[model samples]
Target: MKFSYDYIKSGNATCVLEMGKERFEFYPTFHSDALGDFVSYLASVHPLCKLSWKEGAFHKINGGITWETGTYLLRWELKRDFEDLEIKITEWQNPMIDRKGDSQLIRKVLEAKCNFNEFVLCVVKELDRVIKQRGILGYRQEWQGYTFPIDGFLDLKYACLYKKPFEITKKNNGTSLEAELNLLMEKMD
Candidate 1:
């Protein structure tokens, strides 16, 4: 089976999962904590699932029927969320219903739809590309200093702030020194 995916932002993050000619779109709520969890899950769990299910059993299991079944569930959930959103919107517009209660209900439904596990998985996968491209995982430092070295590159004002002294090697060129100085100044203020 041919599969592809894309992500779009329209007030909220939306993931579009494409399987062959069919397309399924999911909108996941934007929350820092939830997005962090989704990123971690994609970095760990998703690869294993794709290897085990998509490659191993997916092709052999009843000529891909199992994969189709899972897609069916995803489609059903998407449709149900759409219907719920519509109902909530209508209720919110009604004159008899308490305005506050209707608003709350609408928010609740939107949150539920956005937090659905299947939708979240798709979102994580799509976002992983962006995270990787940004080089987020490449930098690993156990301890980060607040100021630059005190030798030639340091600003006298912030030199005392850095407890550990780092040698000003040739690699610490003018551009890097300027960048570090700017960063330190930003932090100090």
Candidate 2:
């Protein structure tokens, strides 16, 4: 099997790997120290390295392993067939940001160990709840005159889950925003 990988540094950092037509994406949130430690271990064993035991196989080559970094949890999973691998680093506690609802949703998803689709569903549900409670105009007003585009959030969700590019324009009009929210909720269903 051929192995190839690339790291994408953008709004959020991600490492992508491709084996044949199959691709896997990893969101590496590790700080320098934790990442350096993992890389050093990998290099120490060279071509034949077994970092740790996981599900009867070496975690570095197959199976999954998790590391706790006080502030976040770093998880790595390698498929048995070697067709895919994923590494996710997420915060242990929700940040004290103004986006309380968003932060709470993220915390719930991480704590529940939900999969990609589950995560998207959770987001959609939370969005629906918020929209229902506060009409689109009210929701926009809560953002302090800032344009909080739901489509952008949807694009990010789709990209992370499907590993493809997606784009959507910002919706400023209340009618348009409500329509878009309804459409997204329908899509999730």
lDDT of 2 by residue, 1-189 (tens): 122212312212344433345555445333322222333332222222221221212124333244443344455432221322232334333233233434333221121222333333344344444445554565445433333334334443344334443322345422345534545555433
Per-residue lDDT of 172 in model 2: 43
In model 1, pairs of residues that clash are none
**lDDT per residue as tens, model 1, 1-189:** 111222423223444444435555544332222233223332222222222212331122111100111112111112223213111111122223344444333212121223233433334333434333322232111112111112222221123234222323344332356644453343321
Provide the global lDDT of candidate 1 against the true structure. Answer: 0.28
Give the lDDT of residue 68 in candidate 1: 14
| Highest TM-score scorer | 2
- In angstroms, give how far residue 4 of model 2 lies from its true place: 37
Tell me the TM-score of model 2: 0.29
Off by over 4 Å in 2: 1-113, 153-189
Give stretches of model 1 more than 4 Å off: 1-11, 32-35, 39-128, 132-189
Provide the clash count, candidate 2: 0
Show the lowest summed lDDT stretch of 10 residues, model 2: 49-58
